[model samples]
Target: MSARRFLPGLVVLCLGAVLARGIELVLGANHLLVAIGLGFVLANAVGVPDRLEPGIATHKLWLGAGIVLMGASLTLDTLLEAGVVVVAVIALVTGSTIVVVELLSRNVFGLADRLGSLLAAGSGICGVSAIVAVGGAIRARESQVAYAAATVLLFDAVTIVVFPIVGDVLELSGTVFGIWAGVSMFSTGPVVAVGFAHSDVAGQWATVTKLARNALIGVVVLGYAGYYARSADGSRPTVRTLWDEFPKFVLGFLALVLVATAGVLSPDQLAAIENAYNWLFVLAFVGLGTEIRLTELRKAGPLPVLVVLIALLVASTLSLATLSVLL
Candidate 1:
């Protein structure tokens, strides 16, 4: 309302963009700017205090902007190019990964059900956004959400760097590599970056597969909402659960897909929209890092890492298998 009140968020916006643009220059013309953001999130999670949570403070605006910018990159053409079987494969692998991660997190690692579910969604869905949206809807603690984000960032970094090399060594086609990367990688931006580095076809199909993967976030969140409601009320849920916890911006994301499909914006515009979101991704990560305590990650014990590794193995195996079959 007041200028003083608005100052903090404005500062976050400026800092996020400046750091993101700087990283863009350093990375030498690449899309891994999101990685910088993700790294920032991990750093903050380990050492930064709770008071400096930028992503939380600016919640509604940046979250929506990030969702919208991501949406701008989606299109029916990209989906068609990726093909129905490939799309189905992406969905199935992601779903399986979530279920497997949930099982391991709860039964094996002894994590609370809510925390495990948040981690599972973060691992299996679109990364921080999905974590935040699902965490908020399910009323999970900020600490659990932060930990899930950190885990996703750590593994996503590994996959983004490692997958391309694997693709090359295996001598896979771009389409196959893209499908593999898109399905296995935790974040869409990195998948796009890795895919493009391999081939144009890889990039296109990776984007398509990632979008298809993203489409699951809203559905999963809504399902969680229903599950939670049922747990709370001792009855089946309907319209009310949807109203309370459904991620509304995901709808806006779908609308952007329609607009892109219709060719309303030029390529440059689409690129700019994606770049803007990439910057937000960076800021969200930096904000995330600013809040972390390095010692806390250590204290989370080896089990979290083990759980993540198992999920990674499952996802990677499924992704490569899908590639071998589909492409």
Candidate 2:
């Protein structure tokens, strides 16, 4: 792609990122949420120019690359220290959440499989990142991707604030509550912010547990790709197709974990890479927001939100059950 052709979309994303940064600095809010919201406002208010569409289409690529860089922040030693309980809780929560959402999307929402799958990933696994990853794995349509993201962001924003308050009210210990937040919250940023808000111990535990959860995303996406290919096309994907469709960035992410565990990179170097990850993610969110049309989301109806609302309850119950053992 020529720089000239890509410049328009790049400019649009840069504007969105600037606005997001300003909002985050002023309000102490999640920048991705702000960026996406800004994108939504521009998309619904005036519409994006055709020149920017090609660049915006690269958001999934940005998202994938960000996930890879995110791995550098996680060390295998920390993962091991988190122990089997945390890993088990994450696995149970991730699997159960996806299953529940997928079922609800079909029976309750009457939604299509493609859109429903993205919602499952977004609400169940991580959020927009996981949604975009699974969306790419399945080759989901742009409208479905937007609907899934809009649906999750709506609920995730509320949890960012509410979870901390609830933890305080319950007077849960930092370790317990950190596990709760790590297992329950839909996104990484909110969980870390809320966990630390509760306590330093909670924050530490939350980061480790959440990173463990995030690492499982690749395996889950691979499973989804297999299931989707079989159910949608009536032919099982061959090894070649799986190799082609599987997210290579996830492998890169795992490699970074090894690098992080190796103890070669200085703290400053790792921090710099993390900052780069944030910028990449911001760009991705800006691209995502630019595509969201309020009109399209409205057409998707209230069921997506309903699905997320139900997920909150399911997540809470599962989180508490796991914490009971861990605590």
Candidate 3:
């Protein structure tokens, strides 16, 4: 590609990242949610001029890169600190949520089994990225993926904003509060920021807990991949199916986390890793925002929105209740 042609995309990437991070810092909250909501508003109420769509749409690649940086923040020590019981608790909460949502999607909502299962897993697993990966693997329709992503983004915003408030109201200890937030929130980025915004100790606990939760993504994906591949054939799976079905970025993401946690990397090196990760997050959110049709979301009617709200309520209730009894 010519330099002139590439420059516009490169510029968009930089600007979107800077804008997202700046907004996050200025808002001192879940600014990504705000940006997404604003994007929805602009696209629906006002308008995204046709000329600017391409630049905004290029954020998907950046989001991928951000995910990689997020892995760098993970360390073996952090995982170990979360403990067996905490791990078990997270497993149960996330696992059960997935199962319940899956059943609801199919039985109650009367959606197709595969798409319903994917949404349940995504919502109950690691949020948008998880949903996106599973959707690709199963060759899910655009509508399914959009609904799943919307579910995650909506709850993510709610959990990130509301969890801290509940923690304070309950007068929960820093450790218990952090663990609650960590286990409940689907995505690591917003949870970490929110936990830290509340307390340093809470931040530390939440980061460790969130990463531990994320580590399960690899396990879940691998399990699904293995099952699907084997069921397809006793031999090897086809390249087309495998490539389309599997999310290759996940392995790279885990590797980045492991390498950073291995104690070989210096502080300066870690800083570089974080920079790359943040940009990827920005890009991913941008892609999500770009693809979202606000009018369509509205037209999908209140049922989907109601489902999201119910899930959020269940998650929050479970989180704080768990903290009360267990902590």
Question: What's the true lDDT of residue 155 in model 3?
Answer: 63
Report lDDT per candidate. Answer: 0.68, 0.75, 0.63
The reply for model 3, stretches above 4 Å from the true place, is 1-6, 9-13, 16-46, 49-55, 70-74, 103-115, 127-183, 186-250, 253-262, 271-293, 304-308, 323-327
**TM-score winner among the candidates?**
2
Instruction: State the TM-score for model 2.
Output: 0.68
Candidate 1 C-alpha lDDT tens digits along 24-71:
677764434344444456455443334434434563455456656666
Task: Point to the candidate with the largest lDDT.
Answer: 2
Error of 1 at 303 (Å): 2.1
Model 1 TM-score, 2 decimals:
0.66
Cα miss at 48, model 3 (Å)? 3.6
lDDT of 1: 0.68
TM-score of each: 0.66, 0.68, 0.66
**Among all windows of ten consecutive residues in candidate 1, which has the lowest summed lDDT?**
284-293
Clashes of each: 21, 0, 9
Of the two candidates 2 and 3, the one with more favorable TM-score, higher being better, is: 2
